[model samples]
Target: MPGFNSEVRKSLQKAFTALADHYGVPTERQHFVEGPPGKALADFAAHHRADVIVMGNAHRKGLGKWVGSTTEHVLNRVPCNIFAVMGAADQ
Candidate 1:
């Protein structure tokens, strides 16, 4: 699972790089976050003085619902606005 996640991240990085290059945007300002979703997101918002937090809502079954512990935690703790993108499965 970790290997798969790593590959997915690499693929995302590649896609983001291509998009950024196409737009003449520097990648230095882009932040790739990989950590416990809730705490890490909160910390990032606080440190960066961010006004919004964007995240994907993975449609997980059973135990995965509880895994939203991160989202819930962040929603409760963070002072910024939260935007959640629903997964295709969720739609």
Candidate 2:
């Protein structure tokens, strides 16, 4: 997490918290992750016996999308499933 922006990270976390809270989902059971998201997600799912991973994509274009995306990273390797939804591009 060196050179990481704490403010941005906190803001992103709050967004998830707010969404979960609205649906009465327990924050206590939520998890935070670092490093490669695909590996972390797959490992967490396997450990927890989770049936699926739900995520949003910023819909990267051109080079970054072709080079490799987190979505592609986990698609074939995960033990379970992934449900990716489209969202506005990251600013």
Q: Tell me, by lDDT, which candidate is best.
A: 1
TM-score of each: 0.61, 0.62
Provide the clashing-pair count of each candidate structure: 0, 0
Candidate 1, superposed: residue stretches over 4 Å from native:
1-25, 61-67
Clashing residue pairs in candidate 1, if any? none
Q: List the residue pairs that clash in candidate 2.
A: none
Candidate lDDT (C-alpha), each: 0.76, 0.72
Best by TM-score: 2
- What lDDT tens digits, residue by residue, belong to model 2 across residues 39-69? 7777777788888888777557775543247
